[model samples]
Target chain A: MTSFFIYKAILVVVVFGIMLMAAMYSTYLERKVAAFIQDRVGPNRAGPFGILQPLADGIKMFMKEEIIPEVANKTLFIVGPCIAMLTAIMAGVVIPWGGELVINGVPYVLQIIDFDFGLLYVFGVVSLGVYGIMIGGWASNNKFSLFGAIRASAQMISYEIAMGLSIIALIMMTGTLSLREIVEFQAGGTGSTWNFWNVVYQPLGFLLFLVCAFAECNRTPFDLPESETELVGGYHTEYSSMKLGFYLFAEYINMFISSAVISTLYFGGTNFPFMNDLGLSQNAITILGTLAFFIKIGFFVFFYMWIRWTLPRFRYDQLMYLGWRVLIPLAIANVAITGLVMILTDRI
Target chain B: MKSLTGRAKVLDNPKMTFKERIYLPAIIGGITITLRHLFKRKATIRYPEEKRTFSPVWRGMHVLKRDDNGAERCTACGLCAVACPAEAITMTAAERKPGEEKLYREEKYAATYEINMLRCIFCGLCEEACPKEAIFLTDRLVSTDYARDGFIYGKDKLVEPVDKRVDVSKRQTPNVLEFKKIKHYRHNR
Candidate 1:
C-alpha cells in the first residue's frame, strides 16, 4: 500500500516537472513565434535562440516589486493567480502520460490516479478554471477588470457546454469514459487502418471539440479577457512580478492540459499501431507509444502558438455570439447526427 | 480600445442574427481560409542567411568618397552642412599644406566629418548640397546593435572602400564638378 502511494507520488512529481518546464518554455516560445510571423528577430542573445529567456524572465519577475490595491480584496488579489496556477496544475493530475511502468516487479499505470469518470473529471477541473479569473477580476477593484471577468466567465461557461457536448458524442462512440481503454483500442491496428482513432471516424466531433478546446483554454480570438487595448491587463490588471508570472504560467499549464485531452480523445492518446507485431518488448513498446503520443501533443501545442501569432483577437460581443449562437448549436447537431449514424451503423 | 461605446456599437456593429450566432459554420469557413494560407508559399523571408533583395537606388547607409588617386574629395565648403534641414551633418575645415597635395584635392578640406545618424532624416539634401560629390547614399545594410550611441555615424563609419564597381564603370571617378554642372545645366534650362 505504501509502495503504491510512493509510485503515485513519483508520477505526480514527474508530470509536475513536465508542466513546469513546458510552461516556462511556452512563454519564451510565444514571443519567438510572434517575432517569426512578423519577420523580425526575437530574443536570440539571452541564449541560443533565446532558450534561456525563460530563466531571465523568471529572474526579472522575482526581483521586481509587488503591489496591492488599497480598496481591493487583498486575500483574493493574491489568491487569484495562485488559484489559477493551482487549478491549471490540478488538471494534469488525472491525465496519463505513459501507459504503464513496472519498477522492481511492481506493475502500475503511469498516472497519478485513473479515475473512472476521467472525462468528466477533466471537465470539472476546467470548469473551476473560471473561478480564478472571476476572483482575480473581482478582487482587482477596477471596473474594467470586473467587466473583463464577466465577459470571460460568460465565454467560458458557453464554450464549456459545447466542449462537454462534443465529448458526449466521443464517449457514446467509445462506450467508455476511461482514457486507458481509448488507448488500448487504438493499439491493435496499423497507422491509417486504426478505426480506434477518433479523428478518422468522428471528424465533425473532432472539429467541434478542437474549437471548443481553444475557447475553453482562453486562447486567441477567444482571449477577450486580457485584450491589451480593451481590458488593459484584464483579470490580472493589478498583478505584478511573480503573481503575474503565476497567471501567465497557469495559461500555459491550461494549454498543456487541453492539448493532452485533445490527444487522448481524438488522436488515440498514447497508443500506436501493432507495437507487439513490431517485435519490440512490452517496456520498449510502452516507452515508444508514450513518446509518439507526446510528439503529437507537441505538434498541437506548436499549432496553438502558430495560430495565436497569426490571428487577431475577437471583439467581446462577437466572442459571446460565436460561443453561444455558433458553437453550442453545431455541437448539439453534431451529437445528434453522430448518435443517429451510430445507431443506423450498429457501431453503438 | 473600447470603441466609443455609444456610437461605435451602432456604426461598426456586425450584428449577430440567428445563424450568425452559431459559430461552427463561420469558424469552418474561416479555418478553410487560414488553412489555404498555411499551405500556400509563405511570404516570410528567414533573415540573416537569406535577405530580401533591395533596389539599386535604395539609399541605405551613407558613404564619403575618395578620388581615384585616393584623395579626400571634400573641400569643407560647408554647403552640405548648411543645406541639411535636420542639422545632422557637422564638419570642421582644415587647410591642406604643400606636401600633402596627394591627400586632398582642394586647399581647404574637411578635417572632421561626422553625422549624428539619429538626427539624420535621410532627406537626401546633404547628397544634393555636396559640391565635391563626396557623400553618397548607397544600398548597404547596417548592423543592428543595442546602444543609442552605436547609431551615430562617424567620419570613419560612413566611409566605404573605393572598390571596383560591379554595376557601374570601374574607370569612372565620381566627379563633383560634373555632377554640379549637370544640376546647374538642368536648373539653367
Candidate 2:
C-alpha cells in the first residue's frame, strides 16, 4: 500500500509537470486564436513557429518584478492561486485514464486511487476551486478585483449546483459513482447489452452537464469574473510575476480536467466499439483507449479556446438569471424526468 | 393617505409557459446555433502567416517629402506655421548662402524648423496653408512613443532625405472624424 502510494505520488508529480506545460501552451494557443480571429500577427518569434513561446514566457514571468499592493492581505494574496492550482491538479486524480494495467502479475488501476465517490470527489474539488479566485480578488483590496471575485464566487457556486444535479441524473442511469465502474458499464462485453452510450440515455443531462461545466470552468459567456473591460485583470489585479502566472495557469488546468471529465462521462470514457473483436493485443487496446480518450478531451479543449474567441461574455445579472432561473430549474426537471422514466420502465 | 400606506411597490412580470420554464429546448437551440459557428472554418485571417490587406488608405507612420530636384520648395514662408491649429510648427529663417541656389529655391529659406508632433493634431490645415507647397501631410500617419518628448519632430526629423519623394499632385490627408459615421458629434446650438 505504501509502495502504491509512492507510485501514485510520483504519477501526480508527472501529471502536474505535463499540466504545467499544457497550461502554458494554452496561453499561447489563446493568443494565436485571438490574433487569427482579429486579423493580427501573434507571437511568432522566440523559437520555431513560436513553439518555444511558452518557455520564453515562463522565463520572463520568473524574472519579472513582484508587485504587491500596500494595503492588501499579503499571505492570502499569495495563497489564492496556490489553492486554485492545487484544486485543479487534484481533480484529475479521480479521472481514470484507462481501466487498469496488469504488470508482473500485479493489477493496478490507471487512476491515482479508486475512490468510491469519484463523482462527488470531482464536485468537491471543483467547489473548492472558486476560493482561489475569491481570496485573490478580496485580498487585492481593489474594488474592481473584489467585484470580479464576487462574480466568480457567485457564478461558480450557482453553476456547481446545476452541475451536481446533472451528475446525479447520470449516476441514476449509470448506477455507479466510481469512474472505473462507469467505464465498465459502457464497455460492450456484457453480451451485446450496451444499447448506446450514456449520452443517448441522458442527452438532456449531458447537455446540462457540459454547459454547467463551461460555467463552472468559467469560459467566455461565463467569464464575467475576468472580464478585461470591467475588472482590469480581475482577481490578479494586484498580483504580478509568478503569482499572476499561477492564477492564469489554474484556469487552463481547470479547463483541461473538465474536458477530461466531460470526455470520460459522456463520450463513453475510453470505451470504443468493435476494438475487442478486431484481434488486437492487450497493450495495443490500452493504447487505443488512451488515444480515443485524448482525442475527445483535446477536441473539447480546442472548442473551449475556439468559443472564447467567438463569443462575447454575459453580463453579471444575465449570468445569475441564467444559472438560477434557467439552468437550476432545467436540471431539477431533468432529474424528475430521468427518475420517472427509470420507474416506469421498471429499471429502478 | 392612511389607506395608501397598505399598498406595496408593484413590479412588472412576464409569464413563462411550460416550455419556457423548462428552457433546455431554447438553451440547446442556442448551443446548436453557436456550434455551427464553432465549426464554420473560423472567419479570420491567421495573420503574419497570412497578411490581410491593410487598405492602402490606412494612416500609419508618416514620411516627409523631397522635391523632384531634391531641393525643398519652401521659401521660408511661415504661412504653414501660422495656419497650424495645433501650434505644432516652429522654424528659424536663415539668409540664402552663396552657391546654394540648387539646394533651396528661396533667398529666405528656413534654417531651422521643428514641429512639436505631440501637439500636431495631423489635421492637414498646415499642408493646405503652405503657399510654397513644402509642408504637407503624407499618406503615412503618426508613429507613437511612450515618452512625451519623442513626439517633438525637429527640422532634421520632419525633412525627408534626398532619395525619397512625395508626389506633389496627390491630395494630403483627409479628416478622419468627418468620415466616421454614427459616432460623429454635432455641435449643440
Candidate 3:
C-alpha cells in the first residue's frame, strides 16, 4: 500500500507538470498558428522560435498591477479564478494516460483514479466550471461583465444537456462509466476479439460531442459569452495581474482536458491501430501507446484552434438556437439510434 | 431611391440555403483557405534586419555637399533659407580668410548652418534653391532620437564627410543637369 501510494504520488506530480507545460505552450502555439494562417511571422525574439515566450508571458502577467475594483465583492473576486483553475486541473485526474506498467512484480496504472463514476465526475467538474465565470463577472459589479457571465452560464447550461446526451449514447454502447474500462473495451486491432474506436460506432454522437466540447470550452463559434466586441474583456474585465492569468490559463487547461476526454471517448484513448499486433514488449507498447494518445490530443487541440481561427463567433440568438434547438434534438436522436442499433444487433 | 451615382451597388438580402445554414461546408472552405495561406510567403520584412529599399527620388535627410578639391561649396547666399516654406533653414555668413582658401571654395562660407528637421517638410526645395549645389537630400533616413532638439540638423550632422562623400546624383535629373550645363547661370560660371 505504501509503495502504491508512492507510485500514485509520482504519477500525480508528472501529470500535473505535463498539464501545466501543455497549457503554457498552448498559448505560444496559438499565437504561432494564428500568425502562420495570417501570412505573418509570429514571435521569434525571446528564445529560438520563441520557445521561451510562455515563460516571458508568465513573468509579465506576474509583474502586472493587481487591481481589485472598489465596487466589487472582494472575496468572490478572489475565489473565482481559483475555482476555475481548480476545476480545470481536477478533470485530468480521471483520464487514463496509458496502459498498465509493471515494475518489480507490481502492476501500476497510469491514471490517477479508476472510479466507476469517472464520467460523472468529469461532468460534475465541467458543470462547476461555469461558477467561476459567473461569480467573477457578478463580483465585478459591471454591466458588461454581468452580461458576459449571464451569457456564459446560459450557453453552458444549454450545451451541457447536449454534451451529456451525446455521451449517453457512448455510455450505452460501452456499458461502463469507468474511463479506463471504456478505453480497454476499444482495445485490440483487426482479427481480434475487441472492437475498434467508439467513433466507428457513433459518428453522429462524436460530432455532437465535438461541437458541445467547443461550446463548453467557450471557444470560437460558441464564444459569444466573452466576445471582445460585445463585452469588453468579458468576465475578467476587472481582473488583472495573475488573477487574469489564472482565468486565461484555465481556459487553455480546459481545452487540453476536453481534447483528452474526446480522444479517450472517441479515438480509443491511448490505443492505436495495430498496437497489439506489434511484437514489442509490454513496456515498449505502453510507452508507444502513451505517445500515440498525446499525438491524438495534440491534433484535437490544433483542430480546436483551427476551428477557432476559421469560424466567426455565433450571435447570441444563433448560439441559443444551435444549443437548445439544433444540438439537443440531434443528440437525442443519436442516443435513440444508438439504442435501436444495439437492440437490432442483439449486442445489448 | 433613384440612384444618384451608377457606381452604387444594390446588395441582396438573400435567404441562406440548407447547405449554408448547416455552415460545415463554408467552414471547411475557410479552413482550407487559411491552410493554404499557412504555407504562403509571409508579407513581413522583419524590420531592422531586413529593410525595404526606398525610391531613388525619395527625399530624406539633408547633406551639405563639397567641391572636388574637398572645399565647402556653400557661399551662404541664403536662397535656401528664403525658399524654405517651413522656415527650417538658418545660417551665418563669414568671410574666408586668406589662409583658408583650401577649406572654402568661395570667398564667403556658412559659419553656422542649421536646419530644423522637425520643421522641414522634406520637399527638396533646399536642393532646388542652392545655387552652389551645396545641399542635397540624401537617401539615408533620419534616425529617431529621444529629444526634439536632437532633430535640429547642425553642420556636424548635415555636412558630408570629406573622406566619404554622399552621392545625390539620382536627385539631379536630366533636365536639371541640362540646365546646369547652360553655364549662363551665375553659379554655373
Candidate 4:
C-alpha cells in the first residue's frame, strides 16, 4: 500500500513537470506559428532556434517587480492567479495518459484516480476556471479588468451548457462517465478493428464540443475577455511579475488539458490501431500507447494554435448569439438524434 | 451622386450565402493560405549578417576623391558649397606650398573641409557641382552616433585613404564621364 502511494506521488510530480514544460513551450510555438503565417523568421536567437526562450522568459518574469494597486483587494488580488493555476492543473487528474504499466508482474493502471464521474469532475473544475478571472478582475479596481471579468464569466457560463450537452450525447453512446471505460469501449479490446472511435459516432457533437472548448479556454474567436484592442490587458491589466506569468501559464495549461480531453474522448486515448498485432511485450505496448496518446494531443494543440492564427475575434453580440442560440440548439439536436439512432438500432 | 469611373460595386451590405454563412469554407481557404506561407521562403533579411546591394545611381555618403597619383583633386573653388541646398559644406582654401605639389593636384586646395551630415540630404547636388571631380557620394551609409558633434564629418572621414581604395565610379555614369571629358577639353583649349 505504501509503495502504491509512493508511485502515485511520483506520477503526480512527473505529470506536473510535464504539464509545466508543455505550457512553457506552447508560448514559443505560438510565436513561431504567428511569424510563419506572416512570412517572417520567428525567434531563432536564444539557444538554437529559440528552444531556450522559455527559460529566458521565465527568468525575466521572475526578476520583474510585483505591483499591487493601492485600492485593490490585497487578499483576492494575490489569490486570483493562484486559483487560476490550481484549477488549470487540477483538470488533468482523472485523464488517463496510457493503458497500464506492469512492474514486477503487477499491473498498475496509468491514471491518477479513476473516478466514476470523471467527465463530470473535469467539467466542474473547468467551469470553476472562470472564478479566477472574476476575482482577479474585480480585485484589480480597474474598469477594464472588471469588464473583462464580466465578459469571461458570461461567456464561460453560456458555453458550459453547450459543452455539457455535447458530452451528454457521448455519454448516451458510451453509457459510462469514466474516461477509461469510454476508451476501453472504443478500443474494443486488444486485437479488434479500429472502427469505434467516438468521432465517427458523434461528428456534430465533436464540433459543438470543439467550439465550446475554444470559448471555455478563452481562445481566439471567443477571446473577448482579454481582447487587446478593446480591453487593454483585460483582467491582468493591473497584474505584473509572476502573478501575470501565473495567469498566462494557466491559460496554456488549460489549453493542454482541453487538448488531452478532446483526444481522450474522440481520438481514442492511448489506443493505437493494430498495436497488438505487432508482437510487442505488454510494457512496450503500453509505452507505444502513451506515445500515440501524446501524438494525438500534440496534433490537437497544433490545431488550436492554427485556428487561433487563422480566425479573428468575434464581436460581443455575435459571440453571445452563437453560444446561446446556435451551439446550444445544435448540441440538443445532436443529443436527440443520437438517442433516436441508438433506439432504432436497438443498441440501448 | 453618380460614380465617376463606373467601376463602383454596390454599397449595400448583401446577405451572406448559405456556404458563406457556415464560414467553414472561408476559414479553410484562409488556413490553406497560411499553410502555403509556412512553406514559402521568409522575407526577413537578417540585418548585420546580410546586406542588400544598392542601385548604381544610389547616393549615400560623401567621399573626397584622389587622382590616380594619390594627389588631392579639390581646388577649393567653393562651387559645391554654393550649390549645396542645405548649406552643409564649408571649406578653407590654402595656396599650394613649395613642396606640396605631390599632395595637391591644383595650385589651390581645401585646407580644412567639413560636411554637417545632420543637414545634408544626400541629394548628390554637391557631386554634380564639383568642377574638379573631388567629391562624390559612394554607396556607404553613415554610421549613427549619440552626439550631434560627431555628425559634422571632417576631411579624415570624407577623404579616401591612401592604401585602401574607395570606388565611387558606379555613381559616375557615362553622361557624367562625357561631361568631365568635355570640360577637360575646354580647359586644355
Scored by TM-score, the top model is: 3
Task: Specify the highest-DockQ model's number.
Answer: 3
**Model 2 chain B: worst 10 consecutive residues (lDDT sum):** B180-189
Q: Which ten residues in a row have the lowest lDDT in candidate 2 chain A?
A: A188-197
When sorted by TM-score, best at the front, the candidate numbers are: 3, 4, 1, 2
Q: Which of the two candidates, 2 or 3, achieves a greater lDDT against the reference?
A: 3
State candidate 2's TM-score. 0.74
Off-target runs (Cα >4 Å) in candidate 1 are A35-43, A185-187, A190-195, A334-348, B1-177, B180-189
Q: What are the TM-scores, per candidate, against the unseen true structure?
A: 0.77, 0.74, 0.95, 0.95
Minimal lDDT window, size 10, model 1 chain A? A187-196
- lDDT per residue for candidate 3 within B121-165, as digits (tens), equals 999887887878899998899988999999988999898889999
Compose the digit string of candidate 2's lDDT tens values, residues A120-214.
89889989999999999999999989988998898898898888888888899888898877877777433465445788888988888888888
What TM-score does chain B alone reach in each candidate, compared with the true chain B?
Answer: 0.75, 0.70, 0.90, 0.89
Q: Model 4, range A123-197, lDDT digits (tens) per residue?
A: 999998999999999999999999999999999999999999999999999999999998887773444455568
Q: Rank candidates by DockQ, best first.
A: 3, 4, 1, 2
> What docking grade does candidate 4 earn?
medium
> What residue pairs are clashing in model 2?
B60-B141
Candidate 4 chain A weakest ten by summed lDDT: A187-196
Give i-RMS (Å) per prediction. 4.6, 5.3, 0.8, 0.8
CA shift at B184, candidate 3, in angstroms?
6.8
lDDT of 3 at A30: 93
RMSD of 4: 2.2
